[model samples]
Target: EAQIMAEPSGNELASAAAKGDLVQLTNLLQKNVNVNAQNGFGRTALQVMKLGNPEIARRLLMSGANPNLKDSTGFAVIHDVARAGFLDTLQTLLEFHADVNIEDAEGNLPLHLAAQEGHVRVVEFLLRRTPTMGNKTLPRARSPLPYFGVRG
Candidate 1:
């Protein structure tokens, strides 16, 4: 049986993303590093890529990064982009097929996160993107209230 090699720590990937070092990121990816590898903090390069350079994040996605890969807390890259109000970044991830209705461990979706963080643009985008969007499990009072300028 062929032995499966351990994935490299995500530190370099994360660092390259953090600094917008696309060259280094491209090199690491060429070396077969796990694009979805998580760091000590359980954050993958794509997860935190939203925090800094969206272009790098987009490139990573093009390099086959899993947009739906969740962190330790079960939050996906889309969730972070939603919370951060990065509409362009959010669009990039969505274009890469990030599930807009994907829920966290607690069953909160990207719309819920955008609503909670008061990212009106993201909330509106999600609302338009998923017209049938409904959090039936979340009580009406606990539903997406950011659009109404209220917190649940």
Candidate 2:
């Protein structure tokens, strides 16, 4: 009885989001599962969601997933989306009112991570939306130059 009444650990939701399984996610939401529940990893469905799928993000956000909730390292879903260069997902998150300026534990904003990772499009998009670019400096600067090398 206690297990039934306990708040969902979000393990299933996290897994569904991680896999980008919109059908399963929809089913879970229909069942009235908590959209923002954290899993054993201390991460929410949005936190572990597949960054490449904007529709999944849209669904989760519409279901009341808190986009600005950070994890142990203070990294939010926006941070991951920016770092991973998922422009669509980022757009969806912003549409849902995710704080583009929220800082991580290291004081790095999503813009910093986007710039450091050499996601030119993401940087440009974030630049247009982010009011402040010079928020906090990274402990060790990661040049976009390295990203180019990897691409090359």
Best by lDDT: 2
Local accuracy of candidate 2 as per-residue lDDT tens digits, 1-152: 43444434599999999999999999888878999999889999999988999999999999999999999988999999999999999999999999988888877778778878889899788878864444544334432334445431
| True-vs-predicted CA distance for residue 76, candidate 1, Å | 0.8
Tens digit of per-residue lDDT, candidate 1, span 66-123:
9988888888888877878889888888889999988888888888888888888888
Looking at candidate 1, what is the lDDT of residue 95?
85
Tell me the TM-score of each prediction against the true structure. 0.81, 0.83
Off by over 4 Å in 1: 1-8, 50-52, 134-138, 146-152
Model 1 CA lDDT for position 126: 95
Query: Lowest lDDT 10-mer window, candidate 2?
Result: 137-146
lDDT of each: 0.80, 0.84
RMSD of each: 5.0, 4.9
Question: How accurate locally is residue 44 in candidate 2, as Cα lDDT from 0 to 100?
Answer: 93
